[model samples]
Target: MTTDSLILPIALPLLGALLATALPRIAPLLGVLTAALTAMSGLWLTGLVWVSGDLSIVLGGWGLPLGIGLSADGLSAALLAMSSLVGLGISVYALGYFSGSERGLHFWPLWLLLWTALNGVFLAADLFNLYVMLELLGLSAAALGALTGSRDAVSANLRYLLVGLLGSITYLLGVALIYTAYGTLDIGLLSERVEPSALVSTSLVLMTAGLALKAALFPLHFWLPPAHANAPAPVSAALSALVVKAAFYLILRLWTDLFATITDAGAAFILGALGAGAILWGSWRALRAERLKLLAAYSTVAQIGYLFLFFPLLQALPPGPARDDLFAACVLMAVTHGFAKAGFFLAAGLVQKKAGHDRIDELGGAAQSMPATTFSIALAGSALIGLPPSGSFIAKWVLMQSALETGQWWWLIVIALGTLLAAAYIFRVLSRAFGQEPTPQCFITDARAEIPALLLALASVALLGLAAGPIWSLLGFEGVQI
Candidate 1:
């Protein structure tokens, strides 16, 4: 509501992380409280943006290129709202997942710190601050992923940490190039100042490459599955649903906003080609995956590919209602995945805990025993497969329409193939629930664990799918014809 409130979403979690680190005994309590407050703050900021257009403020009243700034527009606000809702669900699920365990001592502080970085990334106004927030995000995410202390967890997260650092260094080098050429780091200023040149082209490639590694785009995605699958359940949810999204957000921002003038159809086609590879390869790998969480992780890689497929379409289309609708659809897909994936991971975690293992081939008893969790998986899987009544279904419909309208029908084949593969893998997992194992009497055994997953899944299926028009309004689009 107020300009000062922009800082609360970032500040509250940061302070909570400090307190949680200092007070290990009650860290979970502090963590949950902070999560609630941060979610509320994020929602409030989003509401203000929806009511009033964009909002920005210079911290410390120093103004412009010298002082720190925070801004929220439609794109940032939509992501913030998604992060808030998904993050709150993950936090509540963590409460039950880590109950009375030593893991909670470390999980709370690191998780809160990760939340702080996630918020900071979404709301960051400048490139340098984005890099700083990204560094913190990487460190915190790597730590949280290794909280299980398993050999595999530790090793995977170490690779994650190193890869993340490599990404940071590459991105920082690009930032330095931009600053040297333009004399400013503020995104708003740089957007206006950036011009087509070798230096700018090189910087964009460096930054995009680095972010691609973090986002796990196909060939660069070797590090994601192991890292995501090895983390604790709640940590896995955060990593799959939120952490990688932060990197992709930056890529989207730079491509569509900052470097639009220099970006051409060739560059967009290259990215789209890589995205096609990711879709086929990632989905094929998911179909063959043996573990439940590993499948979810690989599915994430495929889901990310869908976002990139929009680039060529975006580049090909002129700025008009068609382009605006395509852009909004891209955002809608990302937000839908955020909630759907989080719910899927949370429910998968519950099933793993109940089954004592997460092997997809051996989950019959666990799936049958927890009807609510099984149902959660079903709902989330529908979204992943782009089935009707899920947000992804609508987004894909628009996407295919645009592909046909633009005369680039090749993407339609990729989308259809990916959807089929997704359905195959999702149904493969769902099939395990209907075996010889007897069903439980009640639908939900644990309210604390099951409700969050159920609600998040339901939102993806019902809330976002049926009511996605607001996303167009939020993004300042006139409205999609479809």
Candidate 2:
């Protein structure tokens, strides 16, 4: 049953993609149904993990060295759940977003394929399998990013494709080196068999660099803003919310599990330093961005910085409740940003659709004309800003607590500065709503499009924030020192 649950999320979306490609007329409905089923399967698996334990399955009963494996630990399960839920919302929004257009047919299939790759990445237990999934994800995402048919969209995604291929090639080479040394690609087997050596360090650097490029961490993020900002709204949401995190997830998986014995404070601190640069640089750029989507895109760079900041703290703390809290907090922050960014991009899409442009200064009328959309922005912004009662607020709290506890108070200053910048930029958009403009005649301009944004934002604030206790439990941590 556990294996069935794990496979269903990936399989269903692949099936849906084929179905959508074969039956274009019913693509929208098919996408919604497929995404909903996938979400249900992921949620069920998460529940099973929470109630039971982590699951591992080898394909075709060929266990271990000869077979491909899929495993869902608490970490993978949480991410898989986030991907499915966000995907379902995006699918619904795209139905109205594409609305009887020829592009809708293309959108459904690519989006479903992307969803499949996302699930596959989270569940993949071997390095080689993860590489395959990441390539599929990159191709599908790049294709979807170019769906707008604008020259900017096409050019940006073309660059994105080339960069993704480069990153994948580097990552595959690292995998090859490791496999040659260890005679295996299974993450579990490698973790047990591997030892610290020059070969291992080289492989780590190569792999981490490749994954970091994909995660859009700091200087490597050059291709992200344009690719994300110019994509269709639903595509933008998925790209920002789900796609980049997949790479980061693999990085975290390797750093914490497979390479733990070989990793050290110095290496973790170096990554954290890059994260600090990302926070400062990305936030400054976001504040200066004239366009709404670009601001959101830059903000993704900053939020990703926060995820990397966890490493130093994790390294400084010894294994215990404190360490567990920091680890779980990282997952919490990633998932919170997932929901919040998805909502922000979806709401930004609506504003762009109605106003015909997304210039932040010119958005007064569009922001005011749709109260629900405005509210969605506000809610998501609060999460981004780490305002109270949002999941990000809780995550940030835990992060700061860990930092202070470890005597690394320097990170507190970084978090504080990022928080202030987040508030300023977020409210910069909300201030547009206060300007003189005719109010919305109805609370919803389009329920199909607006509701998903509202729901995702609300989840980030209320559902995730108030109920985060379950997250620790879901992650299989027993201590609650935080």
Candidate 3:
């Protein structure tokens, strides 16, 4: 009893992964085809979710407790589509990205596997199943991150893998607690059964800590910069854009439904405070970083900080127009940032390739030389800075309004300051790129490399001025005014 709707997006790549593995040499070509098919199906399935409320598939003809299941609500499908789009872009960019290597063959399979895990986790309505997928994702990502063959890459990935294991174990501990307390791991049923108890509260705290670290929340974000900064470009893009986000999406679901009415207000505030700190600290590092990739990595640290800031706001609002506005705003922030940040990272990859290094101060006169790539980076940076006509702008506006509605003026202040800091760091790079160098490097052309970067960047910017009607619709929340 597979929901034909849910089956295609998840199943196809899985089968493709097997095929690509069997062929070995067709890894690159097959990876692209697989990701492209997944993206298209992701888009189509999202449409099905919108037209119908939610789509679900039960495995092996057993229902509920005895069987596994996948479900797509508005939120799940939107993320699926985003993952597909970003995954496809990563695949295309990787064609020029990994090029020729004994290592490249291994990269394609692991990457597609990562994408499958991401989409699976989002659609998973089963708890233990999600845990299994999480483990798969962590292992694949760590393997991919270590692919560069550089000592630093291996070292950073080792640390990353260690941190990731701790987080997963913590999350698993929470699941064990829930199963012990409630006797079921089905999310929908658990939502109905979840109740406040000493065990429930303890489990909540444990899960929160684990997911926070995985999401690279401040104080626990120590592993992110090193891993991301040291990883290769395509891997870094996937890690930053999609991998870190998987955990955050889990946190959102936990807080929104499972924690229903049992919100630990004090804990929510603590996360918010740390999120703000991450914004400041990460932005400061980005402003100071001598290397392009490190700058982008730190920017991810800052951007992800913004993602967690919504937890407190969602907890504070009453579930009505106020809460819905907060939800929409947060969703907008996540999707918008996903695209923009990925674009920024990909564009940075091209810049590093052309300049032979990514030192900001040394990048004088790049604007005249690599206008397509540079402009795309600058445009993607605009979304990160919350400029108007961008989805981030609209999202931030709604978030600010939510703050005002709740009299959370301090939250308002923090948002404003974060915007200014983001602008400062983003402009630092742009300004350095445009500086008048006595001798601009006559860089060789690689349209194959630059085109994908520009297309992704343009998509990020287009998200601002244009409507997200299709994307939002696919998520089943179109015209979903609160």
RMSD of each: 9.5, 9.6, 9.8
lDDT of 1 at 204: 98
Question: Model 3, range 1-482, lDDT digits (tens) per residue?
Answer: 22666877778788778887898898999989998899998988888888877888787779788898888998887788789888888999998887787677988888888888888889888878888888888988999899887999999999899998999999999999989998899888888888789998888889889888888999899888889877778888899989988998898888897777577778888888898899888888887788878888888888888877787888888789888878978888888888888898899889888889888878888898899988988999999999999999999888877776777768776777678778878887888788876333333368889888877876785553344666777778756343
Give candidate 1's TM-score.
0.90
lDDT of each: 0.92, 0.92, 0.84
Report the number of clashing residue pairs per model: 0, 0, 2
| Candidate 2 residue-wise lDDT, 329-367, digit = tens | 999999999999999999999999988999888777555
Task: Give lDDT tens digits, candidate 1, residues 1-482.
Answer: 38788899899999999999999999999999999999999999999999988989899989788999999999999999999999999999999999999999999999999999999999999999999999999999999999999999999999999999999899999999999899999999999999999999999999999999999998899999999999999999999999999999999999999999999999998888889899988899999998999999999999999999989999999999999999999999999999999999999999889888888877775555898999999999999999999999989998998888888889988987898799989988888765655334365899999999999997896578656889999999886665
TM-score of 2: 0.90
Candidate number with the higher TM-score (2 or 3): 2
Candidate 1 Cα errors over 4 Å, as ranges: 437-482
Name the lDDT value of residue 84 in candidate 2: 77
Order of quality (lDDT): 1, 2, 3
* lDDT value, candidate 1, whole model: 0.92
Best-to-worst TM-score order: 1, 2, 3
Give candidate 2 regions above 4 Å deviation. Answer: 437-482
TM-score of 3: 0.89
True-structure lDDT of candidate 3 = 0.84
The per-residue C-alpha lDDT of model 3 at residue 70 equals 85
